[model samples]
Target: MGDKLTTKTYWESYYSHNHADKKHIKTVCGYYNDFWKTFIDSKNESSTIIEIGGFPGRYLAYLSSKFKLLPTCLDYNSDTSQIEASFRIMNVETYSVLQKDFTKYKTPQTYNYVLSNGFVEHFEDYNHILDLHVDYLAPKGRMLIMIPNMRGYIRFYKYLVDYQNLKIHNLKCMKLKVFKDFAQRHDLKVIHLGYFGGFPLGVHQKSNLFQKLIYKGHRLVFKYVANRLLLKKPSRFFSSSIITILEKQ
Candidate 1:
């Protein structure tokens, strides 16, 4: 999140009503998908992972409990109750929270895995954001960065719907070429880099009558057509997300 655009309260307020409850939050977070499994597994149970800007810790809770990996969360949000509650519900015991600005926060310790879901696209500076993530990442450890694919055909739908919501996101970070450049510049190896998932139009939003009708048709069509398509061969035109996996020298 950008300091100039989004304040700490913005996140707290956003997440306050973002979900119905701690348990139900996982549903909105989506499944950890087949694409993620290629990089999600750990070499050891003690291998640590940290989620930057991971408020609520949905992914952290699931990864920690399922893989028995130690987890940490870094965010500007001061409240950790929901994150703690998520861990408790998942029966995760080894987890911690780093409550502060991720861009500004300094840490002597590094983690085995560093990930950020739907993050890094909020700020204006991708170079600074990527550098910060690398700063706290351990050598040979994988850093996974995922962001919504707004540059695709969905851009038009979002423009017709929530244009303001689109403004906060740095859609350029969703580009594969951008991350490839970063990896080369930093001497980090790209493990996996590509688009993922077919386009999903079912999730609703406030829109005009015409936009609503158009999106409704999309909802019906994508429900069947897009669902059956191969996820590994995601195209930049309408893929739901961009995933990049990098390892340091």
Candidate 2:
């Protein structure tokens, strides 16, 4: 009924307000860890990664540790002092934070990996965003786009728990076909595209006692039973997130 919450002001306000909260930072790091573990490997140890729209830099810190890459973070936020502080607190040895709008800004240097998580969905011109991300890739470089999947069990559970939960999502859902078509149009090769995170085990500081209990139960089940049963067939319709991995042509 009301307009979607997709403005830059909204996010700037949200991040500025919650940037200092340890629980929120932990949750973001945990989410990125789970999503990236499915793709990152030892082969990327020497690759250069640039994260567009990365603010408050937790995910960039994770990538630096996991892949041994000095990642560059580009965001449009007016102030990046807090993000810099976070990098220091995490003991991230090498990283660059630039204050620029990736949607329009051009860079002279390209990277081996262009990555964004939960970023593109906020913009209506998602096609343009994808093109910009592709433009930042070097030859044979990889691009990873991750967003929430609306058709997943997490959405169902959120709605069951609180019907208004969907309103917080600016865009409804990112369809898999949309990413495929975008890649095909740009002549990029799709290396990986699938749903992931079937269990709700990430950190959520605002969750009520019941929600926390549910997350804990899911973690136990995923570690003991679900991991073994779903080792070979991990793709599920009820996964919480959708990941698309692309390589330049």
Against the unseen true structure, what C-alpha lDDT does each candidate score?
0.77, 0.70
Clash counts for the predictions, in order: 0, 0
Shift of residue 224 alpha carbon in model 2, Å? 11
Top candidate on lDDT is 1
Residue 202's lDDT in candidate 2: 50
lDDT of 1 by residue, 1-249 (tens): 444346678778777743324456456544555544666665577789999988878888777776788899988788888888888887888788888787778887999888889778887887678877888788888888888888868788777766767777787677888899888878998989888777746433467798788877877777677755736467888788888888888
List runs of model 2 lying over 4 Å from the truth: 1-5, 16-46, 152-165, 168-173, 199-237
Error of 2 at 204 (Å): 9.2
Candidate 2: minimum summed lDDT over ten consecutive residues — where? 1-10
The residue ranges of model 1 lying beyond 4 angstroms of the native Cα positions read: 1-5, 18-30, 202-205, 230-232
Task: Give the TM-score of each candidate.
Answer: 0.90, 0.73
